[model samples]
Target: MSEAVPLPAGTTLGKSFEYGIDINLGTSAVPEWQPFRRISGFQPTFTPTTQDAQTYDDLGADNSDVTGWSFAIAFNVQVNRNTATGLYLPEIEALLARTRPSAKGEAAVVEVRWYHKPEIGTPNPADAGQGRATVAITRQNTGPNGEIEVLSVTLSGKGPYTEIANPFDGWDSTVAVIGTVGPEGAGDGDLVTITGTGFLGTTGVSIDGASLAATDYTVVSGATIIAALPAGDAGNVPVIVTNAAGASAPHTFTRGA
Candidate 1:
């Protein structure tokens, strides 16, 4: 009899539904990302433009060189309208408004961002992409009797897509809360343990506007950080923690005697 091998821990298959798409309703300088709701069958395609590379030297092998890339995403959403509010879903409204004949050139183009949803209880960052795309909406056939109305929306890439940090990564709600720092009064080179919540991905620690060296701080967990105090004025200085999301509110830390 053959011995059975055990599967590795944390092994799980990726689900097709574990992806999200967002449309930017605001400008590049001030982006407001609104997720597409009630969507299904989200599909993204990256097609490469290739050029014939096979020459007289090659006998019968077919070969080509990739020249460029193109991206597009398609998804279907159930038509939803709030009767009381007399409003359609933001994403649906945006799509319908942009596809109008009056909407031309830049007016028809919208910024888009998409990401792979991160797994629960894991600190893994989301893989994301950003670019501009034009929306196309098509009405789907109504099913026999009970099927709800649906619209298929396709986003055609207007230009090149670029990879970026997931803007919707749950870090915004994980702002570090400074509960307390041991040794209320400490000076330069003093090791201080910071007790707080949401300190997992701390990027920088600053005291009185002076940032600590990267090697001076260690994020032990989501609720603890050990850092060497940087030299600062002798007073109640503000200590702030910054992460991928943003900067946390400054917590007063007594410095010196």
Candidate 2:
């Protein structure tokens, strides 16, 4: 009989949308990572430039040496702007601004970064790549009647991409942090206010590793969450907040008798 193989715990299949791309509209000195949003059919290609190294020694086989590499990303974006801000998407604005006639040498280049967005873990430094790229925009034909306008944008990498940390990992809306839970000694079934940044898309709240039901918690704002405490021992227990990005570090909270 064949033996059964054990798979690693917590293994998960990644989704197509688990990748993220961001462009820095600001300068290198002061970078502002604006997400490339509303994009469809996101495709990134990396090709290696190779030189044939076949010599007399290799009579039939072929050999080549990798000389260089090129990277580029192509995607389509629907024409739209923020309703409240009344401004086009940052990425669209950046690309259009760079295409202007007055945009000379350096102004024509854009800094870009891409990374694998883990569903429930902290950012891994090795999972991201960043580099400079020149933009090419082609406006697609307007559809017959009511279709929205669309633009195809391509970013041709200027040089090699360097691995780096995910820029969005430190953003307030991405990394959940527990600042304070009011009524520190509240017992089970008692409502406690959780004040912290990065609570915008909170997914779960837990006390000492015991997760509270979704109905037991309400995310009031990006910096606050109202949740009833779960049953725990009468003592200090760690409170954690989790979001799509990852779970926050445990914050010690006391439970009243």
Candidate 3:
């Protein structure tokens, strides 16, 4: 404010975009208590935060430094295709004017935003996966009445795999993967095939909770596989298929002498 100023008693001041007496002034002494202009025009370009860093610091000093004040500008921002996957920053600006960086401007915290992604009509199957499973043990054959070992598992899926979990934490009979000796009514020497997707990649086998290496195997397709019977105690044991992706539904085979 430089000097006293006066306007007609009925004069409207500060109101812009709505109403105002256009008072072109070189200097003025008055209170700026109202909006001078309706905010419009080119807003700052910003990125929506998404798994990305976002921060801005702006300040200036001059007492020959004015006190600190924060400026807020708003605009519309775009959202990512995967809404739940990340964070995005739609608008950004240099926090401080380069000419005056010493002044202080404080913001409590960056306002977080969760813009909705494009509506996906069909949901990803993976969202419905990871269901609880039940496993049952049928039988296990011992070579000399001693327990057998379980080596590894293989797996396959219907579509692109996202996640897999192994429930067996390693309790010998329950935690370990069980292998099959043969179908029901087959003697221990009879060959029994363990069927399922992702069986070919099985580098090892398990029987009655013991980890054992495979003898011979074949990859029938990207999905199907056939593996030779592993040497172990003769019996039927639940078989678990597994791979890097994860384990498969538990199956069973019969082994007897």
User: Each candidate: RMSD to true structure?
Assistant: 8.0, 12.9, 32.8
lDDT value for model 1: 0.77
Best by TM-score: 1
Candidate 2: the clashing residue pairs are: none
Ten-residue stretch with the least lDDT total in model 2:
164-173
How well is each residue in 12-119 modelled by candidate 3, as lDDT tens digits?
Answer: 443212211111111111111111122222121222322322334324422133233222222221222235854322221211121144423322112111111112
Question: What 10-residue stretch in candidate 1 is worst by lDDT?
Answer: 117-126
Task: List per-prediction Cα lDDT, in the order shown.
Answer: 0.77, 0.77, 0.30
* TM-score ranking, high to low: 1, 2, 3
Which should have the higher lDDT, number 1 or number 3? 1
lDDT of 2 by residue, 98-155 (tens): 7898887888899988876666655444566778988889988576887777898898
TM-score, candidate 2, is: 0.61
Model 1: how far is 157 from its true place, Å?
Answer: 0.7
Q: What is the lDDT of candidate 3?
A: 0.30
